[model samples]
Target: MKLRCELLLACGLFLALVLIFWSEALPEDRTLFLRDLSAEIIPVRSFWVRSGGFALWNPYSFFGMPYSANPQNQAFYPFNLFYYFFGAERGLVFYIIFHHFLFVFTLYWALREMGFQREGSFLGAIGFSFGGFFCSLSMLVAVLSTLIWFPLIIIFLIRAGKSHWLKPGLGIGLLIALQVFAGEMEIAGISWLLSLFAILFLPEDIRGHLSVRRIFLALGLGIFFGAILSAFQWLITLEFIPLSNRASGFGLVDALLWSIEPFQLKSFVIPNYILPASRLSLSTSAFWGLGFFSEYSYFLSLYSGIIVLLLALFSMGGVRSWKIWFWVLLAGFALAMSMGNTLPVYKFFYFHIPFFNLFRFPSKFLFLFYFALMMLAVYGWQRIQHKPRRIFGFGVLIIGIGLLLYLIFSRLNLEDSSLGAELIAHKFFLRSSLRVLAFFCLGLGLIFLLGSNMRFWLSAGLGVLCFLDLFFAHRYLNPVIKRDFYRGNSYVQEFNNQKRSLVYPPRIASLSAPSEELSFQWLTDPIELYSRLRDGLENYWSTYFGIADLRAYSLFCLSEVSELGKLLAEDSLSPGVRRLALARSGVEYIYYRDYGFVNLSLSYPRALILYQAKIVKDREQIFRIFSDANFPGLRSVLIEAEDKVAGDKNFAPMSDFARVISYENEKVVIDAEARADGWLLLLDSYYPGWRAFVDGKEVRIYRANGFFRAVKIPAGRHRVIFNYFPESFTRGLLISGIGFFLWLFLFGISFKMGKGRK
Candidate 1:
């Protein structure tokens, strides 16, 4: 009966969510992240997979980043295949909501398996799932997929404490493999780290009951098998990371950029009490001199909702176990980790821990606090025995005191210059306080009447209260898009509408900012989300329209692109020098995406697209032209092997008769008439896995202009083509296949041995 009730409520929750997501298209003002990152990539990925093409080389953004190796790609995850059935664009909401329910069920089952009854486990499910962690990362599909696997891994580990090294160990292995394959390694790493910690600190009584040696051996085997299964993804990622911007290491300043402010920590009591609410984004043009907290860290500010918070606090009263204290200490330490600069403990980890410096945003460690909150909340609920009236009275006393203090604070409209963001903070605090008071009162009434009854209905009401608290918080924290919100934008659809007349695979850019409003305090934090919105729109629109956006946003950028971006942002050169440099670099157009009313108007936006200069193809002589920044004489295209071009007697220098034949995501073809020996240089970012062919025969491809690609063309009208074939992906696939077979063979042998022994 308990099981039936939990399952029914879970389904009801999922169905209610679906009504919001599936009935209509997302709204236009929906975050650029949803449209640009998630929607844009999934469709392209599904197309390639369904067509049996190589799931690599995304040509849409950053001069084509490695699709499968990119952590957020979701190309290799099995569950994504299920979502792809509904079509990538339309099915995204389903995927998100699916994971949410999966998280709830997994947490409930895991706790129940650990000896908690339906009530305790259900409260925990509500605490973790609907408490705003997943909601904050709503568009982060891969991360959520990875996160849901975490509880299942713990469940398996718990089983392994009693079982032999075969079944439960394999189960653990399978879950880890699934998580790593889901794309986000950072989230996966955190889960495994937390898992190891939990196992290391298993309660002494439980350890004694299971025998410590058996627990250790099973866990070790499980992790080993899991590592083997996920070797493909990790192998590719390991190879790529050294070449990425994260290779060298980020500084301490960068690590603390989005760290949580200690003052905002009161959000645990009232989720909406955040000082400068993200929903209240105000433009600097309007409020340039005000104080506010415009920095966007992990949302929810560690809010576990008022009901859960109180329940968790209440559950804390009767526990005297030393093991419990250890967990509580760990929780406090985790919270400290979220305070990047405030605590400086992460700095210790940054310097001491391997690969720790490679990551940014230490505030994400809030996951630890979240885990601990659920654990303690369950403990608190379990302690509330048949004497419900006493606890109910205590709860009312607390609420009454809190409400009285809030009333006094509300009456006092104190303002001071040093009190940064206080005005908005107080207003939000007052509203959230009222909500908490109402809920606390309602909870007291429910406990007084039904807490003693101990019926399933009591648990159901508590679950409903959780739903209401989280849903209300979601209103301001992370809102979803409307049904009509997802239709193609006018700016993006322009290329498709005017397809016939435009240049083939025309390079485009979006100079307009993302139209995000900024608050006064945003000036201190340099995330510059508003300014970077143009980046999201540019990549999304360009990818969908089959256009090359010269300005690419990537995890790792080419040195040349870095230089170019630096030059552009700094405006370092004289006007003549700038134009001359750009002309030689094959720059064609500067585009401005019209983002309706919110767009920032630039004075000289035309300068981005207007480049007209002479093209010279001389493999050996181009260095002289680039030696001087202001040199206007004879602009030459730099080629990788000038000596090779000189050695080729038949090499034809082509400049006057270069024409684009065709361009696709994986292939590019051009027709050029060469009057003399030379190399055809393309000013595009170059990476591994690209092959060049002249007409029917394969030719040598070389790097040119520091970061572009070049090919040797013979002295005639020749057809030259470039194709992408990533060896890493191909090799990784083979390795994964081998690993899969190896695991199967091991499992088979283990099963046979067990049966024979029995």
Candidate 2:
């Protein structure tokens, strides 16, 4: 019977996803076109495939940075084999669907293990997997990928505590490791905290004869094992973070940037009541939220389901088990934390908690809140079986109060009575409130009218209604476009064909257009607006077209490269500085939104040999030299004072030349000749791992021009090769291999012990 229920639940989840995203699932030509999908994920995955299915470096973005080391790329994630097998477009569709299924099914399994009946467990699973917080994450694929494992980790920890078994603890470690590989460390950290809470505070029955010492031991094992298992990725990330722009943790104000506004809580019941009348529209002009529209607009509808909220409230009333109250408290905690700066609790946590300052978007804590609410709702459903009339009364009272409040607010005039937008918002709120009340009435009627003995039919009917409620509210959040939308544009193709570096206009310049004009264009014709946006070749769009971009979007960037980018954007500096910086970075073409790609006629060679170098102890001196209008950046180079190179500053190299013979993602080979000793300069971002070889002999690479690599060269023709081989990756791989073997050994022991017990 349990096996049959599991199979049915799986089928229901698959069918729901198909119905919700039919265009993406059934059609070969349609695909999702949400924010990060195009801006970062698809391009990175495509680049990984283009680099022979595994890449250690990405030469296309930020003037070449570590590809595999960027956790967002998910370089070592096992599930990415789908991309390797089916390509990015189809694989992404499958990846999203699979993770959604995983989320629902894992929640169902966990609830069942906690002794909830199949019907109640199914309700909770549906409520959460289709909840506001989870649905809002559709655009953030990495966050969703990491978040799906939260329930599984909690359940495994519970099992390990109950059984005092090494195998279950090891299993939890593996799940945590998978979450880390999913490429959202912030979500993983959040999941770990929630899992710890579950094992430590869960009600006695749910914990199942737990021992305090044993539970702590299991949690410790899981943490230690998970750390070692994911060392390969995290080790490299730790080494890279200090060098990147996010070296220091975020400040409280920055961390609270996306906190849920207290007024926005109405969304949990009324669904986008704060937005304009056409709340379903994707236009940014329609959003009037606290933060950037793009961030909050995707979650316009935070309504999980009217019935789910009602049942959760019902669970809170009446004499309940400690289990139910525990969920209530947990939900309250999550809600308080999600309020961020609006509440004192979040401020306390920010100052006192470790790793709390590392992540932004305090609203993400809603994931835990929704999960707890779903659990309470499940318990309420079970209780309703015996007291259906009581729950019906409670639902009527709640809906009655909600409708009364809606009537009052709809007629009340705002302080800005003349503002037409406020009137439109009021209209939207009234319309949305009516819809929510109608759904609430129908759900209440379902519980009141259905016969007590007709259990399966009642659960199935309510489940369908809940699914429809969430689907209608949030379906438009993820818009689909033609699969070929990713095909390179004419300008992108032309730049790629030329095999030359391209630089886009500064970010501030791109946004300099008047807000009204941008909104008008977006409303009148979004497709044309998108074309204009793409023409700039911003973000990883250039990477998708196989063109290197000097300006690109990334979560982590080398501090030196970021400093150079700032110089390029400084209007106060001489235009010559911008031109010189672009030329030194080997940019042959510059892209402007108004005018397409313009040729830089005096672009410097990508690889060059210089006989003269200035060793500067202060970084400001290098910047000053770069700022000089007459600085000969191409013929001479600035080296850091600590770097000692075997090159003579007075040795004027006659007819010196260097050119790149081969360039791959991880390795570059250059052929050079000089009449006298010189330094070979490669216009790629200088990082810690790259090793330079002169005629198969090792040579130290020095920081050139603040953010480029240079190696000393002899006075004769020779081949110089630069290879990336970071020690962190090597050490991490060894540690992960050991973790894998230890996990396997523990699994074998557990299996034998189970057989003996049987």
Candidate 3:
């Protein structure tokens, strides 16, 4: 009966998620494709599908990058099997829905494991999963996927510590590996930090049963095993990091971007109260925050429901148990740290802590604060069941607070007429506060009138109320678009037919300053803007259409490629200089919103044979040479001084011809005829792990033209092939295989032991 009830509840939760996202649940409807989804993930997934299997290289973006090594690609995540079986479009919707259900179910399971009643656990799960943070971040596939494992990790860590068993430890290890594969290492790091806290400050009952030394050993071993399991993903990521834009970590100020302001705390109680004027604008303009709306607006609706806050406060009133205080303290710590520069604590951690500088957005710490609140609310529910009469007092106090804020804001009068916008914002706040008060009264009435004996009915009513609260508040966050949004674009079709490299305007041209109200008009109606941009082939739409774009969006780019892009985008450089640089990089078309695709007159072929070579010792010198208007980039190549190139350096001009026979994601083939010994330069981003073969014999690849690949060509026609097969991936695969078997063996032992004991 208990198992049946739990299963029913799980089904109910899944159904609720589907209903909340009913528009997106349709086969033709999709979430808005604005940031990472359109620019990075969809295009990469489309390439992977077109390549017929898992591929290592993404030649369409960043001029050829390691696709598997890019963490955000999520190349090895097990859940991506859905994308493989069903196509990228439909599969992404199912993938997101599945993870959201997993989040709610896992949190409920974790709360039950922590000794909460089923009713309370269910309430806590609903509040947290449908809360502001999780709901708003649903569009961010990687972050949402990585965070679903948090509750599971906490549960297994506690189980392992208490049981002193290898099975749960192995489970934790596998969970950790899955998170690493999910492609958001920052969230994975936060999970580990929270798990550490959960174990260190466990409730007295569980802590008393644990052997401290054994628990620590289990945790360390589990972490080590997890590292071994995910060695392939992280090992290549480590190699790529130093070459990436974030090689040296962010500056202190940059790292503090998106820190929650002190005034934003009101968001915890009032919906749409953070930057109320911007919320009223129904767009991203006038966002008076530390970072842009795309970065900070996701977590704006921090209202987890008025009943949740009231119950949590009620739990804090009496001399609570140590477990209750544990959650309270953790919540306080997370709230303070989320203030970033507003508080001194985060600054100290940013300078002193090891990995704190690697990530921006201290507001991410609110995940912990919200998690702690969910736990506290569960405890509060348990207390309220016994002292049911006290609920009305707490509910009245919350309503009174909301009314007080509403009165205060309503009474504020500004003598200066310039505060008109501020007055409108205050009015919005007052309206939202009234809405919160109504919900508070409704929740209080449900609990008080139903009484304690009617547990099932009371729980059902409150569940519906909480769902409505969160649904109405955040339903518009990730709006749905028709499937036709991605298809039938003439620009995409045109680019696909050309099958050549393209260059678009830099991202800065599209970004609007916070003060630019007219510029932000497009943001007010994102669907219309997205539709217009689709016809213009904005962002990485070229990649999705199988067109190689010189400028594409990525979390990080190779330092050399980044510098090259900066030079190309610089207004200080002449258009001729920029065109010359683009021609050398094999850019055949340039996209402009007003003019559409324009053909470049001096575009270089993808493969070229240069008769002359110049060895430059300094990298900057190569850029300087390229910046000059008179440099003959078509005939002469610049080779790095450190790279050794065989053959004649001063070869006379010959009838040398090179043509690309085949170009694929991971491999490229060129048929070349060199009448005299010269150099073959391929305008592809050069990095480690790419090997060249001439007539089935291995040849050295040299860094040419600052950040492209080059190899020596003999005085005969030869077939040259370039393949990307890194040794790190092979070695990591072997280690992961071993770890997999070890985990299986541990599971066997655990199962047998339990069977024997039974």
Candidate 4:
């Protein structure tokens, strides 16, 4: 009953903090939420809505494009789904609230285990829930949600610390399971490794409680859970190792250093006018320097340094034990070392240390340090209480005086600088002053915490602190916020609108296969498509660089299509003997509203000469269009519609078009009109050896482009013949067969080994 009460208080306090902070920052993102809302509405679950049909089954490319482009790999599956069921506007509101809940829940549990008073624990939960780390992560829906379950895992670890035997192993296993489910494996690996180190730092009595059997059991369970969790990724990896060699470190380094620069603190006092390169950078710097507690100059910004210094000074006093101080310092040192330019020999103690190289963004680990600082500040309050209950009143007065002076000076400086009174009045004083005042009140409440044992005051105080800190500090701390992180840039938003702007000038031309219009609706729910249609198209788009479509970015750049051949060959093609190229034409064609936002170019062989290429190429009255059937022989149509609407637009029903059935051993058929139209049948060199005829006349099959194994048919109805040579699909079939057998063999072996061990 007592534990349950404590939990309730913690939850209540956390909610209060979230409400306060959220009221200030909830609608901070205008564009991203709208984009996500738009995605939610897209019926054709496609990353790129080129032509909405099942004609090209390339779903892998859909998901892969986004993952490769952005590091925001944490999926917003639930949020996307939420919007699907609920209306977008209400769905997004629920998502924000839910994430807040998760953020607080994890913290409450972790803090409770750290020996904080229930109220203090609640406060800690609130603080972290609305902390810079949470806000920074929240910029991307996926990353934020992925991290929410992490603290819960850590809480279990703390619990396991109670008994190291069987429970700890089970705890470790549970952590692994949660991490797998969360889909933030790399970050989880780093956190788990840190947790293990922390476990080792426990007192000897606690350490002694652990045994080899327990450790082994925990490890075994972890492996078991990991296998179960990662089975799907493993299965796909059998096709080709899904290993990403791109170092996350440089991006991590850039993300880390970017926030710490002196300019961000100024922006905090000012407005979004002073933009930084990235949000992660800004938030990281805020955590390091102008944190909630101190005021000291860092590379010239005394605001952050001063805050950190004050907190550190407060921590100098001892509470019940010296271990807390030691742990805080240890955590700080770990963060500094990890961020610095040195080989992390200490990291090698874990099995996944080398694997950490895959993710270069080390700054993300600062979250652990941030957690430590919050606890340490509370520790400071706890420590001062030991001096005497009588001194509490005086201490509260002094703390209050100090806070007042800082705010006054900060406000004065803001007004005096070129930062401007109008801006300062609106952006800083009006927007941020209330949060600072609330935080000041929290410090006063902490004094009460020292004097009395009342759980309510402590909870209330902590809640206030969490609210003020997050609400006041995020603008300075998160670059994502400053750069309109969720809103997306100008062009991306434009792409989301269903109607294309004819700014340059042009008219929409109707085609035989009218292209699907890109809609404005996707602006609110871009990831909606990822949820509904699994096999149709890739969905989900974000400005966060690591997990969106690179093709999306290409909208800003223009390059010759032929130049792409070399890159595609190098990156995607197998060890072909030689001569990579693309066919001049295809069996299918695509049309676009304009160059519009789609800038990705198709590759074709140099051997194929361009007869004519025009921006608004037209067959008759159609504009800005492309076609598989040129001004020549064309017959027979097969349209696979990913969306039923696509069939309605482009494809004629089977009854409307002619169908060629296999007649004799010769597998040859032709449409009589093909010859007169002067449309020639062109085959790719990779195509199987074959002969062709039109209206009983022998025609040469010319190999033009290397990529397209195409047979051109004349305008009007024409018969087509295709004979599949045995060698064509041989390697593909062989590879697939071998892979299937090997998977079975491995499964059997693993099963037998497990049985034998048992």
Candidate 3: tens digits of C-alpha lDDT, residues 1-758: 48568857776865676566544455555544544555456666777777775887788675677788887788888888777777776677677778888888888877766656788888888888888888766777888888899888777766776665577777878888888889888888888887676666655665677666766666677788889899999888888889888899888888887788877777778776332221223333332231122223446456677778866876776678887888888898888888987998789888888877887778788888988898788777766554245567466546745764565566433233565554546555666667677677767766666567677787887777777677756665555555566783664465556544423211111221133422223123444455455555555566676666665547566776678767777787888778777777777777654555677776777778878888887888888887778877766888886654543345446325587887777788999988677889888889888999999999889888887999988878999999988888878888999988988888899888768867
Return whichever of 1 and 4 wins on TM-score: 1
Candidate 2 Cα deviation (angstroms), residue 465: 1.5
lDDT by residue for model 2 over 543-613, one digit each (tens)?
77676776664857767766876777777777766776677667776676566577765676778888788
CA shift of 219, model 1, Å:
4.4
Global local distance difference test of model 3: 0.71
> Once superposed on the true structure, which residue ranges of model 1 sit more than 4 Å away at CA?
1-54, 199-227, 273-295, 390-427, 444-458, 483-492, 500-504, 512-541, 555-560, 569-572, 575-585, 594-635, 640-656, 695-697, 717-719, 750-758
Per-candidate Cα RMSD to the true structure, in Å, reads 6.8, 5.2, 5.3, 13.8
Superpose all Cα atoms of candidate 4 onto the true structure and report the RMSD in Å to 1 decimal: 13.8
List the candidates ranked by TM-score, beginning with the highest: 2, 3, 1, 4
lDDT of 4: 0.38
How close to the true structure is residue 479 of candidate 3, measured as C-alpha lDDT? 51
Candidate 1 local lDDT, 570-674, one digit each (tens): 455665555454545443444554442122222111101111122336522344445347443222344454343433222222245366666555677777776
Backbone clash count for every predicted candidate, in the order shown: 14, 0, 0, 69
What TM-score do all the candidates reach, one by one?
Answer: 0.80, 0.88, 0.87, 0.54
